[model samples]
Target chain A: MALNIVVCVKNTPSSLSVELDPSGQPKTAGVLYAINPFDEYAVEEAVRIKEKNAGSTVTALALGPDADQTVLREAVSRGCDAGVLVTGTEVTGGDTLATSRVLAAAIRKLAAAQPVHLVLFGKSTNDSGAGSVGGQVAAWLDWPGVLSVKKIESIDEQAALLWRMMEDGIDKVKVGLPAAVCTVKEINEPRIPSLKGKMAAKKAVFTKWTASDLGLKPEDAGAPGSGARVARYTAPAKRGTGLRIAGGSAAQNAAQLVDTLIERKLI
Target chain B: MNPQGILVVALNQRGQASPATWELLGAGRALADAAKQPLFAVLPGGTAEQARELVERGADRVLWTAHPSLKEFNDEMHTQAVCAAAQQLSPARILLPGSVAGRSLACRLAVKLQAGLATDVSEFSPSGMVKRGAFGGNLTAEVEFKSPIQVMTVQAMAFPPAARQAGRAGEAAELAFAPAAARTEVISFSAEEAGEIDLGGAERIVSGGRGVGGPDGFKAVRDLAHALGAAVGASRAAVDSGWIPYRHQVGLTGRTVRPKLYVACGISGQIQHLAGMSNAANIVAINTDPECPMMQQATISVAADIFEFIPLVVAEIKKRKGVPVAA
Candidate 1:
């Protein structure tokens, strides 16, 4: 059986170059936005699954400002079958729960149109790094789910075989049709899109929706609906003085290094 | 449905609770104690008799759902069971130790419950707060939760274990779960050869970075670790350059370690490398560059070359331990 897959992705600032404005919120001014790095893995995995199965269709979905269509197009370039953007100001300030609710609602709508065999997500976003969104989405949909999937062993029309990494080793797991799977970077090497693919993505018209589109109330999809929230944000403490050993040969350097370690009783 | 409120998933391997589960008991107990909640442990295995052991180990209640399919972790089934219980009790929060399994399940559960998740937290503040690394551990971001039913996955060693009581008896609730057969199966798993202990659980770790030239350079590191009865760790640079196996790498892309004592030799501490070992009780750095970031963070900084100091350090440890250095 051919599979239908949906990848939930986000557009985030490239790095920690974020600052809080007067309100002490993340400063978005002039910060460049790109596809969440981890989500790329999700897209890549979906495409790979589709390629392996031959008849699978992969849709890349994002929930953010309408401008995020640029990021959606990027997923298309990487071989997604379609692109979707769930946008609205009410969707803002959402924690993972709210985020998952919106995505889950959109997923439900999409599933009603065509069967979705699997839902994919990155392990976590660079901004939140909470790694909770995918799990929450799965719960909202009442679907069996897996996270930190490092490998996909088999994917037929009806069931999927995969592995989850553990402290001791990896465990093999099988999920029947219509399951959700989240992956870490270790899962697979995400492929870069080709120029031809990028051209195709640029021309593709992405579908747009909002909370109303998914039949969600405002309170059901943002901070008000989330189960957890950030209390504050702080900078990391500065590490010790950037100390460097003075002029010395490799042997001399080794000597000094050991002396320091010994003095600190480190070795 | 078990009435004992919250279900704490015990960290088990090959059908035994990892010692970390007891530590989780402390976290679980604190939450339960605060919320006036009751705590239960979910252990998957084939033994019913072993259920009492968890109670003895401080579980207020124990639930064992065992099957042959449960022999190896079937996350789908296990997660479903945990969620099934959560749905029944509706605990204010689901607490899991920030181990690999905990992170995986916590995220999956969040999606299921449409709840919020906090991962790898060193300390959790009940004031709706979560602290985690940012900029590769170069900074920490304090996060606030707007959600009521918070989900936190904490590091194993972040909190001390609850005081071990000799015989604190609690109810053991055996669960009936039919493990869903998994499609992917573990063919075989071979632990890294035990010349040194696993970095994750090592009491002492000696790590090296780019300064360790090549594979041959690891000899000094190995010798030092051997003398000190420690595990060996490497920075991403060393691993990427093929100086060490990726398994032995310690950094953002590698294993995060919390050893009692961490000795960094000739390593220029990058944020990524520091994230893996900053939690060590004692950090000692040996480097020629006094300005090296690792040195500044080192509780003790030795400005010397590792080659010169390693041999003597090895000899000193061997002499102190009265163990002859193996040729």
Candidate 2:
């Protein structure tokens, strides 16, 4: 059977430069948002699978603010056959549970047109880094879900043999079709968008959906639908200015460091 | 189902609780106390020894199922087993250690229970809400659960292991679960090479970064690690440059390590990297730049060339340990 796949993407402020306002919320001013780094690997893996399986289609699905359209265009330029952006405050302001639920609903709506063989997500988002949505989406869809997938060793229409990153090492697992998987960084090296691909992306018009379009009520979609709320935001524990050991010969400084470590019983 | 009390769950490692599970127990005990609820522990694939250990580790009640199918992990069947446990107990809150399995299972379980959830939680605010890294670990969000049931997977090394009350006997009941056949089958598991330390639980880690010019630059870092019997870690820059495997990468996206001591060599200590090792008991930064973030946050900062400093540290530690120096 020809497989139909959906890869989810998120665009977030660069991890390297997030500054919080006094209210403990991310200062959105002047922050550059890019396709989450991990999702680049997801899109790459999806496109590769699409290439390997003839007649397969890869749809890039993103649930975020309209600004996330750029990531979808980026995905299309990379290799995705189509792009759909699900926007509105319902998902953008929600927690992982509500967010996963909305995405699962979108998948169901997508399935109404064509059977979705697989759903893909970056292992986690850069902003939250919870790594929960992928597995939760599987739960909502009642499909086999694999988390932290490192490799797809082999895949047929019926099932895919994949490797999951585990505590001690890796587990080789075989998951049936119609499953959801969260891809890790080790999956594949993403390709740069070709000039032609970029031009196509520029001309591509994306399909947009709202929570209401996905059949979710206002209360069941956004912060109102979320089970968890951020009661407050706090700064990370302040680490004291570290002590410096310098102005000595290499051996002497090394010896002093060793002595200090020994004194602290750190080694 | 009426939900009350705190439920602690951890994936078994060869029929025993993983080391981080005890830490979960500690956090659970504290949370349960603050919430004024009973503490419960569920071990779906646990043996009697692990059940006893959990009891000694302060689980007010232990639920275990030694289901054979669960002996080997089949995510579907194992998740079913935990769901069965939760269904039976209907605890108000569930806590798990942030192992790969725990995080995965926790999410699926949350969906099954229709629970509010959080992942990688590091602390609890004064009001009993969870505190977790957000905006790439630069800000902390104190999450409050609105759902009747809450599920969370906590970061490793964030809390101390529960103190074992030796010789204490507690009640453990077999959790009867008729598991559904899993759609996901396990073919095999390849263990990380023996003698190569896992950074997650390592007490000491020697990490390299951008200044480790190439793959060869890691040699000095490795030498220091070997002398100290420590795991080797790397910053994202080094890992991205293909100088080291991703397994050794430590940062927000990589493994979060809370070692007793962390030695950073040639690392610039980006905020992302600091997110992983900032909690270490002691941080020793060896870098050429005096004003770098890693140096500033380090417990001991040495502004020196890693190439020179690493060799000297290795020799000194080896001498202190009474080992012969290499020719």
Candidate 3:
């Protein structure tokens, strides 16, 4: 049986150069956005799986504003067979719960046409880094979810063997197929986009789905349905200016550091 | 359900409550006190001793479950057990430690309860607001819950563990619930080869970056750490280069450490790396490039070759400590 894999991607500010307005909201007018770094790994893993499974296809999906199409295009250029952009004003400023609900709805719609064998996500996004959506999506779909997966040992029609990198150790787990897998950066080295792939991506027609298109009412999506809200923003407190220690040689510097540590009783 | 009290899901490893659990309790106590609500703690698959310890540590009421299926850290079972307790207790706020397992459980619980969740939170206000870093720590956002039930995962070391009272006692109740069959099963767990050093709890740390050159270059770093009795840490660059394991990595995508003294050897601090250790009490940077961000942010900047400097530092420490130097 041909496998259907869906890779979720997010478009975030390319750099940490965010400018907060007076209300502490990020002013994203001039900031450039790119595919989240972790999602690159997800796309790569999906593409590799497709390559291994000759009849399989990889679909990259993103839920955001219209600009998110750029991320979908990037995913297609990297290796995804197709691109999907799920957009709506309600999708903006949604918390992980709302976002997962919307994405789950979209995935369910897609699964109706063709059953999805595997769902993949970056361990977390660079912006939120909450790393909650994958598990929540899995719950909505009633499938098992695994986070921080470093390696996919094997996968077949029945189940998948995975190695998840934990804080103190690695867990080897076997989850029945039709499961959600969140990938870590250590999983694989992502391939660069080829010219032929870029050409295909440029001409690719993205399947666009709005909240209504996904059968989600305004109250069931976006901030209205979000469980949490960012009430305010503040810059982290600054640290004290450092004391520069100068010495004639490396040994002298080392001696000075030792003295300072001893004086402060930090050692 | 009319939520009324604050609930803390005590995280346990091998039946012992994790240090992060106590930290969450400390935060929960404050929130409960300010709200004038009862502070309750739930221990999934925990022992009687662990439950008693939590009560002494400020939990007004302790709810524990030792379900047979919950012998280990199974997300589904743990989540089900905790949710069952929450559903019965009707907690207005649920707090968890922001560990790997904690976050996963918090997410699943949020989905089950339809509660608002904020993970990796550093602070919580009595008014139901949470402060957490976003956009790779470049920005901080204060979050609020829209749902009646609020869920949050506190960052490790963000709050000090609650102190145990000598005679303080609280009621301990057994939580009875049957867990659903888990779709995933853990085959085995293999601990990392790294030594037993809790980076989050360490007072002093010595971290190396890619500039350490190679895997063998970590020798000097390990030596310095050994002399100081400190934990060893690495930048994402070093970990990604395969010079060291991810367990030692200190960065946005890795462990966040707030040691009293952080010594950076041959590390040109990236923003992601700095986010992990910038909260340290004092930072020392030793690198060739003086203009690097790590140098600028360090409390003490030493512009020298770490290869040459670490040995002398180790020797000086050993000499000061009255240890004989090898010829």
Candidate 4:
């Protein structure tokens, strides 16, 4: 079967090295953006599935500000057939529910044209690291969702066998088609984009979707319709000042460390 | 039942009431007490034995249902069960563990209910505010639910497990929901080696990173872990390098853990890595880099090579515990 897959990627800071202001909000100054590391695995997995099953198509779906296009381009460079950027204030700055609703709406719209057999997501976004949008989207779409997916054992029009990775073990799952899945690092090694692919991505144009385009109310995307709202941001508690041990030898340091632990009853 | 009662999803692992469930009960107990509302535990997939355990721990009442479909965790079945329980009980707030399954299920339940949800919540203020990690715990986002029902996945280990009352009495009822066929089937389960400490329940953890060099370097970490009765954790770097298995990886990309003590050996902390274990009661960073983020964040920073220092510390801990040591 020629499956149609939608891989959602998040555009996050290239590195988590950004500084938090005193109020604990991340400072945007000097921040560089790139495709989230985990999403690369999802895009790679989708691309791989597309390659094996000829005539299949992979659509890179993103929801954020205009900066999201960079992530989509990267996805295209990695073999995604097309891209869709869901942006604008009415569809941005949402918590998991809002985000999931918007993504599910976008998927619903895409499925209207061509039935989407599967939706793929990374383990988590580096920024929020909530690790739930994939399943939440599945919920909104009324589709079965599997998280911590390590492998796609097999997929056909009717069903897909997936390996769900848990802390202690792996559970093999057989899910009905048109399911949403979140991929983990153990799935596959993501490939680097070739020059030709990059050139193609440079010239590529992404289809944009918003609340209205997806036939959704403005309240369905952001703070207005969000179940959870950030009341405020606070700096994390400070750790007690460190006690540095750089004394003479390994034995001396070890002795001192043990003594401290004993005195504090930490051991 | 009051409209504002706190409903806890008391989950059973291998048909037993584990610490994770008890922890939810403990937090739920406090929340219910503060609100002066009854505490309810919803056992979506467990027997009466586990339901009794929930009452002994903290629940004032237990809503238990043990359908054959729930014997194994299928997302649709669990969600349907939970949604059914929520619809009937109508809890003001619902809490679940912030574990992998817990988070996944919470996400879906919130969508199904169209409720506000906070994941990895560390604290719930009496005035009805939720504090959770955002930006990988670099910042704390205080969340408020706009919806009528609030749902959250409380951070595991953030609260002490509720103490069991030997003969506490509580009400128990079976939840009735129209059963539907599950959309997923569990074919098989292949678990890691038995006897390895499950990181979610581990009280202490000793972790390694790229600085550990290779597979052999993990032995030092494991030795120290053995001495301290701690679980072994690895950063994504070490796991990706094949020095340790993915199960041991503790970071944003892996498991989020909140142990009593987290010891980092040869691991220069990445923000994503710190996101997983930053909530530990104490952190000790043993690395040569005095300026690394891990060292800066550690309660105790040791400036020394892990290879040379780990053995001495291991021997000292062993000596203190009256265990045999070469030195």
DockQ of each: 0.39, 0.80, 0.75, 0.72
Off by over 4 Å in 4: A17-30
lDDT digits (tens) for residues A168-228 of candidate 1: 5566766776778888667777889989889989899999998888888878977776666
lDDT of 2 by residue, A1-267 (tens): 478999999887765556667777767878888888889988999989999889999999998888889999899999998999999876678888898899999999999999898898887878877889999999888899999898988877789999998767889998998899999888889999988879988998999999889999988778988889887677777788778998889999999999988888887
Error of 4 at B199 (Å): 1.8
- If both were scored by TM-score, which would come out higher, candidate 1 or candidate 4? 4
Candidate 1: deviation at residue B209, Å? 3.3
Docking class of 3: medium
**Recovered native contacts, candidate 2:** 0.85
Give the alpha carbon lDDT tens digit for every residue of B1-327 in model 3.
589889999977655668888888898888888989999999998877788889999998988988877776778888889988897788988998877788778888888888898998987776778898887777788998889888888887788889998668798889988877997888888886657567877889999998899988899999999999988999998998999977788887777777889999989989999878887888999999999999988899999888888889999999998999886
* Top lDDT prediction, candidate number: 4
lDDT of 1 by residue, B1-327 (tens): 322345567756676766677777777777677667787777765366666766776667677766665565555555766776565556666777677667767866766655567777777666546687654554566766544466677776766676666667787776766545554344445444646476766778999899988998899999888877798999988987888876677866677788878889888988668867887877878777877788888776677767777786676566556778566
Report how far off residue A168 is in candidate 3 (Å). 1.0
In candidate 3, which residue ranges exceed 4 Å CA deviation? none
Which of candidates 3 and 4 reaches a greater TM-score?
A: 3
For model 3, how many clashes? Answer: 0
Model 4 chain B poorest 10 in a row by lDDT: B10-19
